[model samples]
Target: MQATPVNPHSSPLVRVALLAYTFLIVYASWYPFSDWHTIGLSPLAYFSEALPRYWTFFDVSINVLGYIPFGILLMLACYPWLPRRWAALLCMLAGSLVSGTMEAVQTYLPSRVPSILDFITNCSGLFIGILMGCVLTPWLLQKDLLRQIRVRWFVPSMSNGLIIVALWPLAQIYPQGYMFGLGQLVPVLSNWLNIYLGIPIDLGSFIRQGAQLSIEQYWLSETIITCCGLIGAVLLFLCLLQPKAPKARLVTLLIFICLGVKSLALALLFKPEHAYSWFSPGAQAGLLVGCLMLYGLAFTPARVQRHLAIFMLTISLLVINFVPGNPYFTDTLSTWVQGKFLNFNGAAQFLAILWPWLAIWFLLHYQPAKSTNPA
Candidate 1:
């Protein structure tokens, strides 16, 4: 007897979603909630907070509840491609690996505290999701709901944009100086351009001196950062979309969203007050341009989009890091390293903040060009 063929669409969607969710968990685990400093505790202190309450209904319910979808989705994605037993085993491994990684990274986030509960909860979610998928697959296939959902919600073209939009708010959980989202790079880049080009722009001062949009004492600085930042993120996603590589597009969007969520959480953990300050036009415009660029790239050939994505992200990362006055050595080395070398404070700070992300991105094999081209 011959084995049945897997649906062309199922596997890719599952892989993309799984990879993206993994990133999200890692991002969320790192950032802790506000009051971390006032409590005189590290971000991982929350692990203890969740401990005494571990056995309570809330803890178990939340843990198991949250991951049910993950497990189900993982199972659904895998079942079509692998043997049932093998798929189950794979799901379990994937769940554990993702949860473990998130817990490990949590140690570095100033606001994020690692916890056994989170690991357990994440695993539970994966397991439950897998189990649900197993139970529902047969019925879903019978009713054709599986195929319907896959075609409708999981289709690469339609799903990619929606998933990114959904993940947008989640990414804002991290509180950075920039408001909108991970697009903090925009304002930082803007400031860098001003300084490098000898253009006079006083963003810092503009932010501090309360600018009003009518009667409200608005922080125009935050508004510019957040709005423009979000636009930039969206554009970044759009730029990576490849018409022939739906799977790649889906995967990219998922990863981006997860990163966005984690970034937001970290922002909140470190600077809760600035959590709501991410709605700026500069950031928004950047995001819009980014989205346009992504759309253009999506229509381009796969090979070109891949390199372009990598180049864009790399440049953005570099700008975000190099342009800022190093928070760590700015005062001490202001005179010596001003234009020639390192801003001790800025470099130290950038490293402190982004090193974890770099590590995760590296470990995850984050190839901007890796695609879902079945061919």
Candidate 2:
């Protein structure tokens, strides 16, 4: 008799990933998180309004594209329980409901508009996404390709790594004060607390320009930030893998993937000419040091590797947050030609500023049992 495989739908990784993404979608659609004023305005009224005349390709495209992953992930999560066809249909329905609810809520916020066009585009995006998921799941889920990949490439217990690695690159889509120094959400959090709860926490670390860095000092600081950031990310990936998984090769692949994502984000946000502009002298130095660090630590015990990842991240965060923004480097923040990018920008920023911390928290919370597997 053939043995039955474990149900993939019961995975904590999938459930948590779904919840995290849902939270992000909700938060982005209702950002600023306050100033909610609904003076005799029915949120549903926007659905009956005419199409938006002032929409741009960027807005429409993002609206359609942003929820694709939700559909894909939702379908994946529903597999092994619901039939594949039902899962895809349910994903589309859920996406439509989320889009509709977000659109309706937008009516209450002065900063956001409830647009019929946005609603339609959002649903359209979800539909395409679910359609894609339906096509891909046949080979990916049903054929047990996901299981094969996981068994071959990852530590059996560390399914969480899939979500982390998948998100790691995309987190770079948001602009950062330091290259790859993500999860610097402290100042943002402080500001929100002060405004929302009258906490009055001092958040001057973000703005207080202390002693000016000598040209060399600036480069050295930048190098450390880059090195620590890269090493921490890679080390975490290494720690999550099975004993026999390919380390050196996978590390190289991960590095290339991150670089590609960063390059793509830079190109899309600014001119293609400015894509490599992020490769500053400091960042270059950091990359070398970080790689050396990764080489040394790659074979460490998994528990030890986790400790090192946390330590490196803590040091990097301290240095990056303490240092003020570079005056010499110019950002294209004010030059955005249209309003279409605003929502997308906010979502990416939210991810970039929060994912690292969340990753760290997950690592800290996870205590492996005595079993040989991470599961």
Candidate with best lDDT: 2
**Residue lDDT tens for model 1, 178-290:** 33424334355457669778777655434535332331212333333333343344434443443343644564665466455544544423344433333345455555555
Off by over 4 Å in 2: 1-12, 185-209, 330-338, 368-375
The candidate that wins on TM-score is 2
Candidate 1 has what TM-score?
A: 0.42
Worst 10 residues of 2 by lDDT: 1-10
How well does candidate 2 match the true structure, expressed as C-alpha RMSD?
A: 4.2
In candidate 2, position 27 carries an lDDT of 78
lDDT of 2 by residue, 1-375 (tens): 122343454445666688777877887888756688887978899878999777678778878888887877786677566676667667878888999999899888888888989889888878887777667666676676777666666665676765776688888877666788787766677888898799987564535544567778878878878888887788778877777677898889888888888887777776687677679899888998888878879877888888888888777877777765665543554443335456666778878877668777867875542324334
Per-candidate RMSD, Å? 12.4, 4.2
Model 2's TM-score against the true structure = 0.86
The candidate 1 region of ten consecutive residues with least summed lDDT is 336-345
